[model samples]
Target: MADRDSLIADFLSRTAWAGARRAPLAGDASNRRYERLTDPATGRTAVLMDAPPVKGEDVRPFVRIAQFLRGAGLSAPEIFAEDTVYGFLLLEDLGDDLFARVLERRPDLENSLYEAGIDVLAALHAVDPPDLPSYDPALMSELAALAFDKYRSGVVGDANDGIRAEFVARFRQLLEHAATPERPVLIQRDYHAENLLWLPERSGPARVGLLDFQDAMLGHPAYDLVSLLQDARRDVPPAIETAMIDRFVTRTGADRAAFLPAYAVLGAQRNLRILGVFARLGMEHGKPHYVDLIPRVWRLLQHDLDHPALDPVATLLRAALPEPTPDNLQRLKRQ
Candidate 1:
């Protein structure tokens, strides 16, 4: 802890923010931490990102992606200074106008905010994505299994090795069949409301400030779209969700037939993964509040499963996992 404090002090000093007032900012699930640094004389503020290397966190991806997004004319934060050795970055503070916060204060702006969010995806999918890791079926399937291995197993106890094998085989087969995209695009793996900022002052896609994109990958465009519309943290109105989908399809000229199935498949995969993640967070990580969101995620999962294309995966999951009943949720939370 002393070393971390010293490193932060050195980083700020080198960045010419030695006398700034630093206040803690809420952190996400990762090991990274952030601070809002205010210059006393100038009263200007910047964000300090501290991703310590010892915790397996790296600032390089965030730096690289920030440059890419800015070059692409998006509203990623501007990099001011970086200390890659200690994993600290001083960035232009994008302010706190996060989509979730804005909507909470002004429900009337919900539709327009969501439209901008969808437009950002449309613009992103229209271009050739940067070189990144592939979000392929094999990798996706492996991630999806976390639900069964961590969440489900935590709830119902471990399944025998043979049953687990069958479960994985069925899951992978269904995902492989449904993941056919005519042209894959860069997917901001966590493109939900929480990660998006409402920068109405900026123009076009730039009005939507992007955040938490270090895990961007090459994948079907529908993956990020699904993430935005089927958010686990907030209830997106069905009409707004439908309008955004139509807008994206129109703007990108995506084949509705192909895109819809891909959307459903990816949605199912993502929501299922979240179920496992939330369960693991509660059971293994001792963050029990995450369990409260499982019912909402399960509803989204069921919605995706309603698509005929995902019947096999849905059937298997339905048979294997318990419903998010009060009792079941209570039991999982206690774990």
Candidate 2:
């Protein structure tokens, strides 16, 4: 494939591409491949995505959500064209800069970046959305089940499957207690720094461009916030996280009396799910980068659980994790 210089030309000819060449880009969690195309016709560069739907890499939802989001004045990648069945997409190029890259260069920019992210999220949540298939209750249940299947699948040791049972039972209790707001909104499920591209143009309100939004859904608002504040790849400063939350509260004008507890509970719920996923990725998917994040994620999980606002979940994980010991995790990691 490396020697196949004409592959891009052939693909473009097959797709009637106006681009000069195709440059492949790396991906995560999906079998789909991406190539940046420089089309001469219309003098526009677009992204060419090849998703083998047979391999469960459908691109329709991404298309639909992007359309709907753009209608709402958001800067989702615009679709230039598509081949639905074969799973090919021509998308408006959003430049090479990503939010992760922005943060790496300017640590002092976090405050503004986080504020802009939260503001956009608030607008999305304020849409008074139409009914759409959501992952609210579904995700809550699935996360519990995942903890059992992945974490307690005899992978982490003394805990075993029994620990899964305990976690699920407690998770159920937490879900039923917190649940979600009946008023749902389109959730950019993976709206973290990495999925955001910093585009200063058309950047007045939406300072960042959205990516990997095929997983968008009508769901809980806090889920996305948790993803940002407790980012998997970066440690968002505590002050930054607090300021973002405050800005969200102020912009929405939601009752403070109700916001803190629910946010804490959702934060706790989400981190627990991520913990299981981290372990599962290492043991099942053979991915080690996710494994390294386990300790940091564990600390975040405990930090949220320990919050008085989320006393119940905090109590549960504290009981589950116990007095921290090198041996406990070392032995548990074996399971």
CA error at residue 266 for candidate 1, angstroms: 0.3
lDDT of 2 by residue, 208-246 (tens): 788887877777667788888988778888998888888
**All models: lDDT?**
0.87, 0.70
Q: Say which candidate scores most in TM-score.
A: 1
Q: Which window of 10 residues has the lowest lDDT sum in candidate 1?
A: 159-168
182 Cα displacement, candidate 1 (Å) = 2.6
TM agreement with the true structure for every prediction = 0.97, 0.86
Point out where model 1 deviates above 4 Å: none
